[model samples]
Target: MKTARAMRGAAARRSGRRGEVLAALWLMAKGYRILGFRLRTPQAEIDLLAIRGRTLAVVEVKRRTDLLTALETVSLDQRERLRRAAAAVAAQRPALAGASVRLDLMALAPGRLPMHIPDAWKGA
Candidate 1:
């Protein structure tokens, strides 16, 4: 039998994956093409990478009780990490070389449609 902590960890991972899938579908509905999911680079792990027109979106998915809480959860350090990860990924793919990067957030709450906030933060 799994320990309590292990069970919680597994549940969290499941929730995260669900949130990411919802976020990807939401992005696609908005005309963005998903480039990757849970992409791990040397800089950080990106939840989702998408492109629409000339913009490349580095999306972070949050499953929370409230949108405000989800939005507040991304710290400055996390934002910087996402930016760095985006840079690393972009460099690796010629298709993304000239695209502009936008840090985005997809907030998911129970019974509510996914809330996508484009340009969610300006990285420092």
Candidate 2:
């Protein structure tokens, strides 16, 4: 039973990573320059960071069996963490600090279309 549970958890993580890759590709197709994937900071981690024109976009990718589930995954605290992580990245790249920074959420569900929500959160 423990082995089964571990396998399931591993599979879920793998699926989530795959969804993130798909989300990254979708953003690239939209002319966004991909900066990093699964970027880790001391404070938090950002799933995807991209640049479009002069705008810096911090993206969170959530994958679930359905759209509703995916949307629910991005909680307030999670959004805040993304925002902070974006700031950390900006500190390293000073040019990004001067540009417009935006927070975005991308939802990917099996057998469904990908949904991109720009400015998904506000002051959280």
| lDDT, candidate 2, 1-124, per-residue tens | 5698899999988987898899999999999999999999976788899999988999889876766676677887777777787888898987786877788889887688888887777654
**Which runs in model 2 stand beyond 4 Å of their true positions?**
none
**lDDT (10s digit) by residue, model 1, range 5-49:** 999999999989988998999999999999999999888899999
Question: Least lDDT summed over 10 consecutive residues: which range in candidate 1?
Answer: 115-124
Q: What is the TM-score of each candidate against the true structure?
A: 0.96, 0.88
Q: Write down the TM-score for model 2.
A: 0.88
CA lDDT scores, all candidates in order: 0.92, 0.84
Error of 1 at 89 (Å): 0.7
Distance from true location, Cα of 117 in model 1, Å: 0.1
Clashing pairs in 2: none
Backbone collisions counted per model: 0, 0
